[model samples]
Target: MHIQQLTIENFRNLATQTLNFHPQQNYISGCNGSGKTALLEALYSLGRGKSFRETQTRHIIAHQKDFYRLIAKIIDDKAEHLLGIERQTRDYRIRLDGENLSGLSALADLLPIQMLNSDHFALIDQGPEHRRRFTDYGLFYQDSRFLPAWQRYQYALKNRNAALRDNWPDEHIRPWHHQLSQTAQLIDQLRQIYLNDLEARLNYYHAELGGLETLNIRYHRGWAQDKTLEELLIQHLPRDRQLKHTRDGIHRAEWRIYAQEQDIAHYFSRGQQKTLLCALILAQNQVIQESSGKQPIILIDDITAELDPKRRELLLQFLTDSGAQLFITSIEALDTPKNRQHFFIQAGQLTPQS
Candidate 1:
């Protein structure tokens, strides 16, 4: 999917404006605090329901403005869509093609976006939540059964946890256990399949992106392999009751990255870690494109930071070859042949240079 036009109003430092976009490449340039990243944040919010930079709506809205609004004209699979979002202090509204939508998933379905920035390094440096979320993002687009199974598992887990917390009888807790075990198995299977595909693509992109060491990913299913989820849950019931929550389940599942059998975080330098993260995201983009046959919009903030010229060029080339619409921000305009349009932003004003 590609955006044809974007309209912004009262969003951060960006002045109210409407700008056209190229289908393949768009380079946004400016000095610090020039609202370049805010432009990308506006677009990212349309795909994801919230901002990656700030979580609070009060801060996201322009100073003294009651709300912030974004509207995009998108082309996906040869059809045009009008997507709009309006965010207020405590509420938000979304509309697609003139129809009011209830949730953000609809927008995510239509506009699959992959974001790259300094904060994303957490995929390797942070805890299991980040890695699990990374895996689930792919699974959400790839597997039809993932969302429902995930919802069911969450529901069962909540009820099971409550039962333990409230000291419910074993019979009452057993039913939730059954539900949890069943859904857990399904989720575990789907995640494994998705990870297998991701690992293969990750290795391919890692090599193509000039990575040297042999990289591997190991999956932990949140329980001993020899025991079924049902067995594990049964065996851990007493401890779970004592702890007032189930600790050993799919919710605790994690995946780790390794370079030649050592953790990448320890083995790779800061730059190498960032490069590997880029490869991982690019691999995700490729997997989404191949499985869904819909190209996702790629957003990169501060594309030149930390990355050396050679790696940056390789990253840009790979993105260009993927045929996905790109929105990249830099302190100064990059000298590149693939850039089709350039926009300069300063102090809330945006001017198209080409």
Candidate 2:
């Protein structure tokens, strides 16, 4: 899906604005604090159903403004659709084609977006939560069974943890254990299959960046790989009660990346890490397109700041060939020639440049 127009008001320092956008590529350029990133965030909120940088709505609403509003006209193969959102301090209202939505997932169904910023390389350097989010976001778009299985697993885990904390007997917690094991097994199997599909794609893209093909990412099922999840969950029951938490399961699973048999982020340079993360994200993006036949709107914030000249060219070339609609922001305009809808952002204003 692609956004044809965006209307934003009371969002950060951005003034009231309604702007038309090209379907293929949109370039937003301005100096720092000129509302370049804010415009991107305005569009991002419509897709994600929340602000990209802030948890609370009040943090994103302009000073002295009670609320912020955004509207977007999106087009897909089926038809054109309208999505809108308005947020107060803690609550939000969302609409699709004039009808209200029950939750943000409904909006996400209309427009799936992927974003990358300066801190995006943290996907490798940070803790397991980052990798889990990366895995789930990609699977959420591709695997319909993923969400329900994840929900069931989470529910079972919560109840099971409660029993452990309360010192419940084995029989009392066995039922929840069974549920957790069943769901975790499904999650684990699906994740492995998903990664298997992505392995070749990851290698191909990483090699395209002129990096050596020494990438190896493996899914480590939190317990032992040899044993079944149900068997292992029961085996861990004794220690789990002592720890008062579910410690060994798919919930604790991790995706370990290795570069030339050495761990990622430890041996790789800053540019290499960014390139690796970009390949991984783009590989997942390719999986989404392969499964859904729709390329997600890609929000790239200040991409040139982090990469060297050759790596930057490689990344830009890869993005250009992806056929995905792009909304890229930068301090100064790059030398890209394929994009037609270019704008300069100065003090929250968008002036068309080409």
lDDT of 2 by residue, 1-354 (tens): 689988988999998989998887788888999998888788888878877778877889999999999988999989999888999997889988999998776766678888888767767788887788788877877788998999999998899899999999999988887788788888988888887777778888898887785788878867787887788778888989899998878889888788778888798988778888778868988998887687888888986786777977777677768777888888888775665688998888898885
Q: Tell me, by lDDT, which candidate is best.
A: 1
Error of 1 at 63 (Å): 1.9
Strongest candidate by TM-score = 1
What does candidate 1 score on TM? 0.95
lDDT of 2 at 167: 99
List the candidate 1 regions with Cα displacement exceeding 4 Å: 336-339
- TM-score per prediction, in order, is 0.95, 0.93
Give one digit per residue, the lDDT tens place, for model 1 in 1-354.
799999999999999999999999899999999999899899899888889889799999999999999999999877999999999999999999999999877887888888999988888888899889888888889987988899899999999999999999988998887788898999999999988888888888888878888788899989889988888888899999999999978899999889888999888999788878889989999888887788889999998885788888888889888898999999988874554988899997889885
Q: Give the distance in Å from residue 39's predicted Cα in candidate 2 to where it truly belongs.
A: 2.1
Candidate 2 at residue 345, lDDT?
Answer: 88
Model 2, residue 305: distance off in Å is 0.4
The count of backbone overlaps in candidate 1 is: 0
Clashes of each: 0, 0
Off by more than 4 A, model 2: 165-171, 336-339
